[model samples]
Target: MKCVGLCPAFVVELWGVLEGLCCVRRLGFTKVELNTDSEAVGQLVKEGRVTSLLGNTLAKQRKLLEFDWIIDISHTYCEVNKCVDGLANFL
Candidate 1:
C-alpha cells in the first residue's frame, strides 16, 4: 500500500520501511529491495543495529525476516532518489 502523510521526515521514512516489511510478509514474498535516502537508516539496517528511538519497531522488522528472505537495502542521494522526488515538491 503506497502512502503519504503529514509527519516529520524521520517518522515517515521509518514508517515506510516498516510498512513495506508488513506488506512483503503479507504477500509471502521472500525477497525485498528497499531504498532510502537516509544513510543513517541504511547503515542501521545493513549492520542490524537498532537505535534506541526505534528499537521496538526495528525488532519487529527483524522478526519478520526469519523467513530467510533476501533483503537488500541501500542508500542513495535524495536528489537521485526517484521514489521521493514528488514528495520533495511538498517541501
Candidate 2:
C-alpha cells in the first residue's frame, strides 16, 4: 500500500508490507490486507485503473519504490563522482 510520509523509515516499512502482499499472492492467495492510510487509498481510487485492493496496493508500492535502494545508491554515487571530478580539475 502507498503510505504518505516524508520519513525514510516509514516509507521502507510500507515498502516491506507491499512486498509481503506480493509474496502472498505468488503463493496462490487471492487476497491481502493493506494496512495503510486513507490518503494512499484515495490516490489509488483516483487513478481509476486499480480495481482490486491488492492490485492497487502493489501498484502504489511499485510506484513509490520505482527507484529502489540500488538505483538510489547508483544515482548518489554518480553525483558524488562528478563532484569529485570537478574538485580534481580545480586542484
Candidate 3:
C-alpha cells in the first residue's frame, strides 16, 4: 500500500487481496479468512460486478476464486487493522 501513486485505491486494494490469496493458496492453505479495509472489494468479490476503474483486475480476482475451498472475505475498519497494516509496511 506504499507509494502506489495515481491508481484508484479500490483497484490497488483489490489487487492486494488477490495477491494475498495467491500466496495463501501456494502455501497449501485452502481455507482463508481474509480481511480488507475496502468495502468495495468485499461487495464486488461477494457479488460479481465490474464497476470500478480496475474492473479487469477485479474480474481477475474473481477468476482466482475458482478453487475448491472455503474463503471468507471480511471487512475491518482501519482502526482495527492496525497490526496487519503496520506489518505490511515492513514488507
Q: What lDDT score goes with residue 85 in model 3? A: 78
lDDT of 2 by residue, 1-91 (tens): 3455565643444454556545655565543434333344334433424445256555665554342221111112324457644653575
Q: What is candidate 1's lDDT per residue for 1-91, written digit by digit as tens? A: 3455566777567777788888887898887888888877777666767778779867877776566788888887878866576675565
Give lDDT tens digits, candidate 3, residues 23-74.
8888989789989898878888888677756677777777777788789988
The all-Cα superposition gives candidate 3 an RMSD in Å to the true structure of 2.4
Q: On lDDT, who's better, 2 or 3?
A: 3
Please estimate how well model 2 matches the true structure, expressed as its whole-model Cα lDDT.
0.44
What TM-score does structure 2 among the candidates reach? Answer: 0.31
lDDT of each: 0.75, 0.44, 0.80
Clashing pairs in 2: none
The segments of candidate 3 whose C-alpha lies over 4 angstroms from its true place after superposition are 1-5, 88-91
Poorly placed runs, candidate 2 (over 4 Å): 1-7, 36-91
**Runs off by more than 4 Å, candidate 1:** 1-8, 87-91
- Per-candidate TM vs. native? 0.73, 0.31, 0.81
Number of the top TM-score candidate = 3
